[model samples]
Target chain A: MFYDNEMTLSFRAISSNEAFARVSVAAFALQLDPAVSEITEIKTAVSEAVTNSIIHAYDNGDGIVHIWCGCAGNKLYIEISDNGKGIENIETAMEPLFTTKPEQERSGLGFTIMQSFMNNIEVSSELGRGTKVTMEKSIGE
Target chain B: MSVGFKTLNNCLIVEIDGEIDHHFVDNVKKSIDSQAVQKGYSNIIFDFKNVDFMDSAGIGMIIGRYKFTKKNGGITSVACLSDNLKRIMMVSGLYRIIKIYNTVEEATKAV
Candidate 1:
């Protein structure tokens, strides 16, 4: 027998309200059986990515955040991509405790939390181009 | 998410509702620390009665608070954790450092 399942969702990266949509997607994809902890982790990670795009990428506060998810062979994959002011230095941004918005008290731990939650994280960004974050996690059945 | 704080025997009693995830960890930490400092409360009792979910970030935040309180010669306790949060706390090794109480009153009194 062969089993192949995939899911995808796309929405504007405009407001925090949209972040909640990703949680619903993850929850539904997991058949509502995911551990509460797992669900929370995925939601937070997605929120961080989307917020980064809204605040950093689309500094004008208007753009689209594309998200895609797929499940294959007991592994879940999530991709969040944004076309905006691309990152100049991905290395510095990923560092813990580094934030551009110091006045806002941003912890700059978004990428760190995402990496910690997911099994694998791959970031692709180009100055003046865009950013795409690919994350993968293994589901326990 | 629901957040409320009160004072008991000079200790701060923080009641958390809804999911305690990374999204709210920083806010919760900052709020509690600021309140404790402002109100001059050395000890803190976290009431998790209404919390339905938590993740590793939540554990990290709790451990961080424990250290903060410990350094000040104060203590921290947790109360009414849901079974899921309890298991996560156990796996994250939080139970080893922070004391757990059956009720908020007990935790407040112990501190």
Candidate 2:
């Protein structure tokens, strides 16, 4: 049950738009009165989620990446979804330092960073369908 | 982001401005690599006073450069990080490989 309002945004799946997506959501999260550390953590989580959508989801092709953010009390909820190729092994994908695109110098810490900084994270995907990442954080805590 | 380079005591000091994310990482890497490699500096120092935001991509960028310099028997150090970024770096385990300093002068002097 969301106590506060929500906002959603969608942008093309491109590297340039990754920063925009993260920053936009972080800006939208300002209403929660997040500390600097909280904002940075949220931005980092958004960056990882959006970058995953751009690189692994669409294979760096043209597609759409969507972000939804809302505040409920002192909690912040964010979901980043993409309509592209889904992960084959989410268990492996979530492993620390596990990256599918090592050739591109991917650190494989995207999911780990998000998991580390957020209070809760859930990933759901189906091959040939898409991937959705929903995460929650205690903004004012 | 704008990257400025300065030479000090056979070390390359890179001043990084603006945010570092997946998008700007390639440019940041290439620019720093060209100078660090061509000059054959014995060490490199990255100044992050102006950086506002960074992610795992920035970690990769720094590690890649660290490997390049280390492969050449050179050292690397970083200076001036916001508290938030420092926390991220600690979680990423960068402190094990890269030395952190309070300022560019300190990094250049020590490295």
Best by TM-score: 2
Question: Which consecutive 10 residues in model 1 chain A have the weakest lDDT in total?
Answer: A13-22
The Cα error of candidate 2 at residue A83, in Å, is 1.0
Which pairs clash (backbone N, Cα, C closer than 3 Å) in model 2?
none
Per-residue alpha-carbon lDDT of candidate 1 for residues A108-136, written as tens digits (9 for 90 to 100): 66687678777888899988778999988
Q: How does model 1 score by TM-score?
A: 0.67
* lDDT: worst 10-residue window of model 1 chain B: B85-94
Give per-residue CA lDDT, model 2, range A1-141, as digits (tens): 845879999999989887788789889889988888888899899999999999899998989999888888888889999999999999999998888887677888899899999999999999999999999998766
* lDDT, residue A58, candidate 2: 96
Candidate 1 lDDT for residue B103: 93
Report residue B109 deviation for candidate 1 (angstroms): 5.2
**Model 2 lDDT tens row, B6-109:** 99888999988988888988677887888887887858898899998889998888888788888889888889999977987898888888898999888877
RMSD, one per candidate, in order: 4.9, 1.3
